[model samples]
Every structure is written in C-alpha cells, then in structure tokens.
Target: MWMNEKIKASEVELTGLNGEDIGIVPTREALAMARKLKVDLVCTSLMSSPPPCRLVAAADAKKEAQAAKAKSSDRVVKVKEIRLTPNIEEHDLDTKKQQAARILQAGNAVMLVVRVQGKEGAAAKVLLEDLVRELKEWGRAKTGIQVSGKQAAVQIDPVA
Candidate 1:
C-alpha cells in the first residue's frame, strides 16, 4: 500500500476522489492531481500491470483499512488449550470446566489434555470423557477422547 511520494510505478490505473475511473495515467500526473485535491495518492493494487492508484484522504484510507482488519480478526477461530492431571481435585476440575465453557461461548475450540503417569493413563481417559459430558450444553466433543501412552486429549467445539 504505497502512498504519495513512495509509489514506485511509472504509470498507474487511477480512480478519482469520487471513485470515477480515470484510466491509466503517468504516476507524476496522478500525484499532481492528488496534490491539487488535497488527497493522498494511494497505490491500492501493486500486482496489476499499471498498478491501481486511488485519490483518497489519508485518514479515511487508514480508518477503512483498520475496520477491514478488525472485521477479519473477529472471524478467526482459535484453539484454547486446558491442561489437566489425572489426579486433579474436584474443585480444580470445576475451575477448568468453567474456563472451557467461557472459551466455547466465545466461538473457539477447546482442547483438553490430561497428562498421566503409568497406572493413571486409564484414569486420564475417563476424566476427559466425564469433562466432555459435563460441558455438553456449551460445546460438543469434536472427537472422542484419544488416549496414547501417558496422555489423553479431546477437542470440543462451540455448539452452533
């Protein structure tokens, strides 16, 4: 997004202040026009052959870009991780469950991982299954509890 004197293209496909296409014009000419209108010469698309440039107020363009970025960020789904131990106490489990519920309500996936030692491996799997059942109203298990060696994990996605 080159602006003003930073635009390197010798020619540009110009769009006027009112969004009217001004066809391809020399870069210097476009800059002159923008200067006359008291707007910045913004190079909108650098991939095109002539590079598309537009005449717009710098502040307005900045606000539009920020708005677009914010809108895009809102749709991004993140995976929230909650780690637990097989011998976790009842109170601690409840705390983790509440945390997971909050993450699910925010439209994110929660991955519950339980680490165990030797004989506690089986307990870890059972613990994850019970947790999933308790959180069923807020989120559904995306995958059944997966147990491998000393770890058990399950992914829960927000109920849509």
Candidate 2:
C-alpha cells in the first residue's frame, strides 16, 4: 500500500476520505489533497490504468484489520476424539462416556473409535452399536459405524 511520497505513480484514481470517487488526478495533487484532509493516500488497486488510491487514516485501517482478525479467531470449533477397545472394562467405558459428554456439551464434535484385534474384530460391530446407544443422549451419530481393517469409527455432533 504505497502512501504519500512513497507512491511513484504519476497519476492515480483518487477516492475521498468518505469513500466518494474523486476521479483520476496527478499523484502530487492527490498527495496535497490528502495532506489537507489530514489523512494518508493509500494505494488500493494497482491493476487499473492509473492505480486507485483512497484518502484514509492509517490508524483507522489498522484498527479495522485488527478487529476483523479478532472476530475471525473467535469462531473456531474443535473436534475431540475418544478411543476405545472392544473389550474395554465397564468403569473405563463410563469414564470415556463422561469425557465425550463434556466435549459435546461444549459444542464440539466427537469421534468414537473402537479398535479390534484378532478375535475381537468380529465383535467390533456390536461394541460400536452399544457405544452409540450409550451416547445417544449426548449427540446423534453423524456417520454410522464404518469399519476399516481393525478399527470401527463413528462421528457425533452436539444435540442442539
């Protein structure tokens, strides 16, 4: 964003501080107008025949950019994953369920993964069904149990 004396363009399409078009004018005259308004001549577009420049306070532009950055950063959502085995003990299952419930309550998505090995592979489907039933109160399953090799997985999102 070339501004003031740093702008080497001979002519520029100028816009007023209030965003009204001031048409194309010599760079020197634009700089003089910007100085009179107590604002900087910011080069906004360089692709036109004469680069487009706007009269604006640099501080205001920086503040607007910072506000936009903060607003964007606040909307991020996180996905949480919980891993389980087909033979998971009752107490362990309860603990995992609590963790998943907390994640769902916080408006995050949860991925339930059931790992099976050897003989347990045949029971993976049943284990996943029970897990989905137990977690029904917390969230609805977005993806039905999908088994791939040694693992079966389901994705659940918050109820509301």
Largest lDDT belongs to which candidate? 1
- Checking candidate 1 for backbone clashes, the offending pairs are none
- Candidate 1's displacement at residue 61, Å, is 26
User: What TM-score would each prediction reach against the true structure?
Assistant: 0.56, 0.53
Compared with the true structure, all predictions reach lDDT values of: 0.91, 0.84
Task: Specify the poorest-scoring 10-residue window by lDDT in model 1.
Answer: 68-77
lDDT of 1 by residue, 1-160 (tens): 5788999989999999889999999999999998898898988778888999899997887887787778877776799999999999999999999999999999999999999788898889889989999999999998988888878999999997
For model 1, the superposed segments whose C-alpha errors exceed 4 Å read 1-74
Per candidate, the number of residue pairs that clash is 0, 0
lDDT of 2 by residue, 28-126 (tens): 999998888788888866788799888889797566557767888775557798999988899998999899989988988899888878777657778
Error of 1 at 79 (Å): 0.5
Using alpha carbons, what is the TM-score of model 2? 0.53
